[model samples]
Target chain A: MEQDPRDLEKAQAYWRENIRYVAILLAVWFLVSFGAGILFVDVLNGVRIGGFKLGFWFAQQGSMLVFVVLIFIYVWLMNRLDRKYQYDE
Target chain B: MDPWSVQTWTYILVAITFTLYIGIAVWSKARSTRDFYVAGGGVSPWANGMATAADWMSAASFISMAGIISFAGYDGAVYLMGWTGGYVLLALLLAPYLRKFGKFTVPDFIGDRYYSKQARLVAVACALLVSFTYVAGQMRGVGIVFSRFLEVDITSGVLIGMAIVLFYAVLGGMKGITYTQVAQYCVLICAFMIPAIFISIQMTGNPIPQWGFGSTLSDGSGMYLLDKLDGLSQELGFSAYTEGSKSRVDVLAITLALMVGTAGLPHVIIRFFTVKRVRDARKSAGLALLLIAVLYTTAPAVAVFARTNMIETVSNRPYDSMPEWFGKWEATGLIDFTDRNGDGVIQYVQDPERNELRIDRDIMVLANPEIARLPNWLVALVAAGGLAAALSTAAGLLLVISASVSHDLIKKTLRPGISEKGELRAARLSAVVAVAVAGYFGIHPPGFVAAVVALAFGLAAASFFPAIILGIFHKRMNREGAVAGMVAGVATMIFYILKFKFGVFDGGQAAAAGLTGDWWFGISPEGFGAVAMLVNFAVALVVMRFTAPPPAAVQDLVEDIRIPGGAREAGPAPH
Candidate 1:
């Protein structure tokens, strides 16, 4: 049996969309963890959230929450893509 | 008998559970070569996620990470950030595509994609390098956790853990490891959270471990646990509990390096392959993140609770009045209290920086429940949790090593004519050999286990992440490009690490002396993984532009990998 070229192209397209989302998430990941947590910490220290400093939250807790959301979003989005492309399996 | 009963029973119970899991894995072992390496390709998404969690959560996360957080204060979130943040990259960027490609091993994906055996070989080398370093650390962690609880020598502890891990991994192969890891994840999480709940209840009257972190201590001072921790840190000349002093740039770089490194790690990606479908891979990653968050979220709270309790108890106490935990941990060489002022009392102060004692950071997390005079069973539970974390991760890493040697090196390169049974035999043999080597390294670790573990992450970030990312996304990447990128990234990282670790070239006692020579872009060797990854991308792209595209057949193979229908057409045999 021969292989289908279009199937491969579709896969590549899926790959591109996935990568785009990941890259964006990576940027946010960088911003929240390093940006808010460390770089802008002094500025963020002025801003408080529920008795906890905002910057400290990013360093200790906020970044982790973002990561969890990112993964869940990725899974949900990819599942939709998988179905759209008839690659549900 | 009572002291040993809970501790001994926990070990025995965990051992029996692991044995049964391994037995089940063997019974459901993969049938074909693909099955042997990646399961029969029918794992449910949730189960796969559990397996990945088991694989990803190591001794560090299970045991030492909380300890580090307890000691390092807010700065310790680096582990939480780097480890969890990397999964975003994995789920969004890596897992789905790798699943779509549907390869048995990472090297398999690279090899077929690049149309170059050379590319595959380079990947195999990187996988071996990353896996071995990581496995060595896990083995060492297993030994440490066992030694502390079982009252056995570190060497014996390592050997015992190795024997059990080898049984399931070799017998069941990837399928076996996958299932066993799920069990491991359960054991580890339960063990970790149980102790945490008890300690939190004692400290804050809150049963929810995660929320208990922000609660006020029982002293009626109205100060939150973290606030008290910040105060103690200042008194000890340490940075505030919620603040770090390292340059924002360096911390950013290190965190980025860890995230990318986590995504690129071979052992982690391999877990995705165990599931049957591409969608399952995506779901698995999400599930893994959720399971890990259980511990990552609770860890900081544990650290804060432990730190505040330790300070409040020890402050102004005469040296002779120090608690039993001090002596117990000090015997382990993890806790050291030095009275610089000779004041006849343990003076924990944040000012007059020279007046402080340096306690090992790893001691804070695990020893917290014990330090607070929690029950003996809770301490035993912590020991079990630590063992689960170390052993599961170690088993996963050892599988990578064993697979690379038996499947990639021996079968792919050396002798393809070996029968399936013979190959399985070789794979099992390799597993045993890998365990022995890793156990040796763990017992005689090079430096601090946690620091050395960070270097492994750096190495993975530099070498494997780039190659895998490029192989899937860039169709034009050739053998030369992949090889050049991997070599450049890994070599640069190694040179940087050696300079600092062994004092190679110049022993720079002065920070500035080794700054330029050792560091690239002012990022420490521990944080250079990000830099290495960038260098890999640039090198691969440049090299590919100069080189030709992969052959038509390889391109077609990529297309085939993407399409689900052709799997049955190509079938198991390569005609």
Candidate 2:
């Protein structure tokens, strides 16, 4: 168990921040996949970028690219958080 | 076949690649249990990323997904999105935490977290069932590829595949499988991308398939590729290519099920364990998805290109004018054309009775190079790529089976006193048995292999996903809640699968016809996994409220895993 109050607080702060990042990122995940890809697809199909409709693009390709980007962003943010909290070895 | 024929080229490419794989396997044979199970837990993020991508992309993704997409059109997004999106969940929601826990298998984490052997047993059974269902399909895939391309009978193909998998999986274990998978990833990706690029350049002026997917055709028509497809589909009495035919709710449910199921799979989860640190786990998951996206994003373009090319080539063309591929594939029974109107020309329309052409969806990918009239070597590359995909995945699934039996079942539960050397021996023996059984299924596949494969995803989504999530994130979750939840989840999924998919109790094969229209909430049996997973989450939370709180030790372990930094320095949590 952590004896120092500051250490405990820092850990708690780090975890809270991590969860917040997850929530925000997952919302984007939900938006791209479930939102644009499915629910709003018909509506978004009205808009086109060359051969790809906005929704069709999201469904087949856009959402996947975003997913890859989202993970790397999470990694970068979490690594920075660890440094900020002095959790880095 | 002549010496310079496509068949000759396919044989040479297949032989050279197989020898390369066997050589790699021999050089990297495993010596210890850690080496066997997790590649000594020292694989680089890049290599692990490639291996995971290769392992996760089975024969379905490589050989069949594009074909399915070609037939399904807009409805195919469910698979494209479902498979790729799950990696986000894996990286963010699971991987780092699991790595911090730092065990060999998923069962070890679940059993320890819930603090019950019974929970572990539930997990092990689920893993074995899912992995076995999956490996059989892969072996069958290998047989199909060989039969179609190399002119080898399916049984020989399956046996040869079995021998190769057994050699590496039993000898080098995870160490051999991981490195070999990395090489397979290279072969498969190159095989997949080269054809896509060639075809893309042929269709559109753009060389980038992803961009070419959205570009206007090179036929000097300003109409975009997708627009042309949609127009052609409507002209032929099929629905517009960009518009889905399935109900929206069914699409949502299927997508969600596939996404959750991908994350829950034991073989996928174990790949993270091979990497050393928590961050490596997260980074590698990203890399895996990116690599997968290379093939996935290209598929839609290929689908559009092939669908259009096929329609233009033979839609109303005369029987005598039909190309060589027409008769070749027809002999394979994937394509059949009859002169329904007693006219010499073929009628490949949407009206079933008037339609003179019958084409199996799998032919799209198999006949793609021929459709494009590409060179012999590109066709051969596709065969080699298909084999790499099927074998890599089969080897991965076999390892999961062997590990579940030897490490989780025998060492942890049945005989905790077994020596390390003894356990390693058991793992190898289990792998050998697994390869043989998988080969059997490949040769004499059950009639319901496809349905059972769907059930494998459903089972993973229902049972393992909820159990593992609650274990990692919920402090109050106890043995009773987990055990009850897993059992309830799996039972619900099985009941749905049997009732709708197999129709075991209803009317068997006869009821299978009515089953599609009779789905609950209009969600098909394949999509029922999401509903079942929700049921699992509900049952677990409700059960946890009544059960005694977990011990303090379990909570500490959760805390330790939550922080992604220096898991080693934290030391193991007391059980």
Top lDDT prediction, candidate number? 2
RMSD of 1: 3.1
lDDT of model 1 at position B208: 83
Residue-level lDDT tens digits of model 2 in A1-89: 65488766776788899899999999999999999999999999999888889998999889989999999999899889888887764
Query: Which tens-of-lDDT digit does each residue in B1-575 have in candidate 2?
Result: 56778888888998998888889899998988888998988889999999999999999999899989988888999999999988999998999888888888999988999989988999999999999999999999999888888778899989988988888888889999999999999999999899889999999988999999799999897889899999899999999988969999999999999999999999999999988788888889999999999999998888888899999999888999988888888877878888978999989889998999998887787789889999989998998999999999999999999999999999998998998889999999999999999999999999998789779989999988999889877888998888888888899999988888778886687355765777889998889999989999998999999989999889888877888777551112333
Flag clash pairs in model 2. Answer: B30-B172
| DockQ of all predictions against the true structure, Cα-based | 0.57, 0.80
Cα displacement (Å) at residue A32, model 1? 3.2
Candidate 2, CAPRI quality class derived from DockQ: medium
Question: CA lDDT of B557 in candidate 1?
Answer: 57
What lDDT score is found at residue B62 in candidate 2? 91
lDDT of residue B117 for candidate 1: 73
TM-score of each: 0.92, 0.97
Clash totals, every prediction = 7, 1
